[model samples]
Target: MPNITFHTKHIFSALLLFLVFGIQAFSKDIKQCDLLIQNGIDAMWEKDHVKSLELLTEARTLAEKNHWYKQLFLATNNIGANYYNLLDYGEALNYYLESYTIAVKHLEPKYEMIVLNNIAILYSKKKDFEKANEYFKKAYDIAVENKDEVKIGLYAMNLGNVANETNNLKKARDYFNESLPLLKSNPQFEILAKMAIAENDLLQKNYNQAQVTAETLLKTTKDLNYHDIGISLLMILSKSNFEQNNLDLASDYAQKIFARKPNLETKVAVFKLLSDINQKKMHFDLALQFKDSIIKAERELNEINNGRAFENNRVKFEIENYKKEIALNEAQLSNERKIFYSVLAIIIIVVFFVILTLRNLSVKHKQKKLIAERNEQIISLELEKKKSDNLLLEKMISEKETASLLEHEKLKNEIEQKNRKLSAKALYLSGRNELIEETLQSLSKLPEISNNNLLTNHIQTLKSHLKTDAEWDSFITHFEEVNQTFLNNLKTKHPKLNANDIRFITYIYMNLSTKEISSMLNITAEACRKRKERIANRMELSSEIPLYDYLSTL
Candidate 1:
């Protein structure tokens, strides 16, 4: 029995190990597949279409096997790009449609927008302008919704080019202008936008404006080595100059277009411009020569057009077959979906009843539990109420104490301010008394004033009034009122300080000069200074710490 149990445990452990290894291997493969898709996209950007197709095909197979819908969509779309670049429109359309279907199935709007733009470009290549415009608009709306500036600029440029082909000059100009700001970071799109603007000006018979725009575009394209745009700009310049009857300038630009060895279309345009210019100048021989060149260029252009038409027809045929296959698949899927919904509906009904039964049982159980919990909560709440009441009472007491302290501080400040004012008035009164005493003494010393008994009597009355201790008592009372705390604190801290010493410190605390203290004290400044020195020595203060500073603290 013990051996059997050990073997069973070992078997279980082996199965678990197998599952873990299997999952790890699967995850590693998924990462490798994703890396291949990324590398494929990078290759496509490098214009290695063959290498891109090989890598993307491998990624697509892996994604399909793993049921990774997102990577599958990306791989399929890049595969389409490879074929599109190779000019295999039929295969490109097939893969693009597959990617579009996957994107829609997965509800991936970003991939959907990308596939829509590719489909529009393919249709435009096929010269199915109406269908191209429809798809472009769809992609444009998605780009706007996503706030994708790059995609918006790309779609706008494509729409403008299409509009220009269809001779909708106003719409073309509007789209070109709209794309310009968004495409400023992309030099290729910027040059294309400028070229479109020049073309639009020429078409509108704004020859001077067209010439200026085209010449500027020509300079930019030449500097950038963008020969395609340069050729287009040269054609525009030739046409503009010829229209304005600048035959010599028109001939020079037309020859420049030919000298660049432009494509058949641009060459044809240049030849036609040269022919017109020569005919306008009545040079029949050169005019005939340019016309013959135009015929040859047109013949070459026709052959190219024929090949494109054949390719378009082939793509159209493939598209029709794909549509038929899609229709059949849709029909099959519709049947399957109907069966699925039927089973789903019956399961939902059973689930609803089961849920309802469980909910009723749950509610009954919960109600009993809730009743006990409510009682417990009521007990807890009562305890909390008591605690809250105590806290509230403490807060109320604290607030009342705070208010009382604030009121006491306010009243103390008011009393201090009144005492200070009274002290100032006492100082003024002391000065007045000194002046009156001085005047009386001066009169007494005068020889003419000695005979004046009335003056002498007045002086005697003033001296009697000034000699009274009432003013001193009043001044001391006021000073004590303001400095009561300082006096108390000083007396408690320094028991040896006498009333006279305290009065001397009070004058110093008031920041009064020695002369002012002498006038207030009816003593000489020297006597006031000696009093301060005596206090400082009594306090044992060092000479480095001034006596006035020490007295001011008290």
Candidate 2:
């Protein structure tokens, strides 16, 4: 094994990270669990799975007690995340679902979005792009609602990756660009920056720029130890060198990939590249041997390994799920036991209270009997003995209090009326928003969004809300109409396209640029561009018109 030494300056940086997390932890209790979860996230970003579990376990333990749904959600998220790093997708997905279930229970939109984003990421990895896109878009909506720039940025990055995988470089660049501005000083963010820049430069065929950015990533990822991305960067760098005919540099990079991964697939590619280099150097024997080795390795790597790991994980997951069910049952039994004990204690307390009350009632009954006996004497002396005048005073006080309460009731009714007015306004706006969505659907059924007078009144009503200065709630109904009418019309025209596909095309033909399309649709620009290109290809456009220009013609 090669002792790959990276730069040693990361110790101080690691300490600084710890200190930052520690300070956040010290500032408050329970409320700062999000900060703890953030630390766990940083650990995951650094590829320190062991540390990730430690922080996340501590964070998850307090989730029920703390209001930090994010912390609890992230604890489950990190567990799956670590499994993902290990390439154990099944376990990762299981944990991801556990987190998602908690988010649903809490009705927390933000963490629910994270679960959705991660699910999309996993599906994409599994080559289920359709499902991946669905999940990613759902997550993007919640992220937008929460104004979480970080999550939006990550969605862009992942969408770019999906674009890159699908051979849509133009779209990939757009998505990467959207993410670049939002990532701050995290190690993972730095790698993503390099990756996005790499995608952009590579798409433009700016080999030098790509090489420089990739090399910078190589330098920074020492303590980060993200070997998978590092190796991919190396592969691209090698490809760039090979394209530029720098065979010596290309050979060095190929060697790095082989050394880092050493898997059969990588070895075959590396061996082929080495063979080419050696043949160029007139080392015929070495080249021929590499070629032979590549053939044998190909057979072993492709046949013996395919689906083997996945099947193993499926079995493991099933077993673990069964165990979890048993544990849950045990927990329920324990809870039942606790409830039984509690009920018993309550019954004992009730019995004690009842005994005391019965004794008091008996004494009261005796006192009442005495009062009954004295009633006749009191009646005889009633005129002379105005000694119980205190009782009359109590009656007068009660009457005065009732009158005061009646006076206050009038003010309460006025406040209730004001609240009712506000609530009515809210319900009106909600109903209008729904109506606009229906209108948008109708508009989309036609070739163009209808500016016809039928909707003129509805749009006017919505605009009136803005005059009342309900900024956030205003314009929502109008946009809903725009979205629905325009989209539904397009779907009617093109029934072959799915809901997502129709939305993708509607935005394009509406003169929305690729970046705007991605942002509005909560997709990566690369995805938007690719989807557009795909639609254009399906329609069989010619080179005489650009894809977007042709889409406008539609």
Candidate 3:
């Protein structure tokens, strides 16, 4: 009886060992499957779709074998994303539907919402707005229910983009506005939202507001080096300036967009803008040149699209084959599972002690390895944090310098504008003095006034007033205030120049015409020209250097 009890105890221990090892192996496979799926997601973020597909496919195999519903859903969804990026829309839709089915079967609302949103994006790309909007609304409702602010903003922006594409400007603007607050954390998305708003403003013929919005966004994009969004903002600015008849400014923005090496669609739009601007400016030759460029760009774009279509077809065929292979593997795994279990049960009875010893050692080894890796990661993070802090400091310094330079430029422009106004006032005063002098001369020559002593005396007093230096001195002082250091600099450069010569240079520096200068000096225009020639000679300037240009250097 004691011998019988010992044999029964041994049999019970064998069964328990088999159960424990089987469950451990299954758990290990599930963990590996999850790790692969995470790696696949990282690959997707890096835009390596081919590698991502491979990783996700391996993960899917493991998930299907172990019947891990959550991992299966993720692996399947990522597979769809790979095909979607590859432009195999048909295959992409098939996998997406499979993922959706899994999500529904498992009652996973989060996965369902994400899959729906992706489907909406795919439809929007295909220009099926009706279906896109339907899916977007469904996804948006789910996001709202889950209180996912990020997804909410993303859907709103997508809807806005679709509305803008359809030329529903009002609806697009409203949607973009709704997205702004939600997407503020993501600057790129915020920029895109504002760009949509600016585009709407342009479509509605609100050129000024559109220009302001586009320009503000443009500065932000340039600072961030966001070339893609910069292209869109530049296009909006070009259109806004074009509609407002600012042809030169429009051409400048369009040319900047071209210089950034835009893609086919943006290039076509830029070429069209250039053509229209040139045509408006009566530059028929340039217009024709841009029109030819447009044709070339459009032809290239068509060829590119065709190539993509062919590639998509090939990818779709490959995906179909891959699906068949996965199905076959599933069938084979199902057939092999019972046989494997029977074998595993017998092996466990023989190897239970050995397996337990190895597993314990392995667990300890893994713990030490994990501790080492954690230490390395901590050090790496510290170094990275220091580098980030350094980069942030450099960026702050650069921004501050840029702000300082801009402030200096603003002050310089304000001074120049004030000088221009002062010069205009001085010119008006000179013209008035000239007119009074001419009136006095004409009155003195009139026959009716020749014999009147009182009139003659009044004319004489006026002549004395014109001869006084007070008014001239006052004008010179005001001119000096506007053009600070100008007269002094000129005198320092040419000490031989007299006060009259200095005054002539000041008038030339103000960019006054020869006739205006002659009137100011109460001399003939020919005399003023001769005076300029004399000053140029005195300064020993070559004929290539005009007197006005030389005076400007002062």
Error of 2 at 434 (Å): 63
The C-alpha stretches of model 2 lying farther than 4 A from their native spots are 1-79, 82-88, 94-98, 101-107, 137-141, 212-224, 227-230, 258-269, 275-288, 291-554
271-380: candidate 2 lDDT, tens digit per residue: 77777776665555576566667666765754443344444344344434443444455446655755565565556456445544555676556545644555554454
What TM-score goes with each of the models? 0.50, 0.45, 0.57
Model 1's alpha-carbon lDDT is 0.74
Better of 1 and 2 by lDDT: 1
- lDDT winner among the candidates? 3
Candidates ranked, most accurate by TM-score first: 3, 1, 2
Tens-digit per-residue lDDT, 315-398, candidate 3: 444544554565566556644754564465456434544434555676556545645665565566566556655755665576
Global lDDT scores for all candidate models? 0.74, 0.64, 0.76
Candidate 1 lowest-lDDT run of ten: 315-324
State the lDDT of candidate 1 residue by residue for 77-101, as single tens digits: 8888877865657668989999999
Angstrom error of the Cα, residue 231, model 1: value is 2.0
Query: Which residue pairs does candidate 1 place in steric collision?
Result: none
**Cα displacement (Å) at residue 488, model 2:** 48
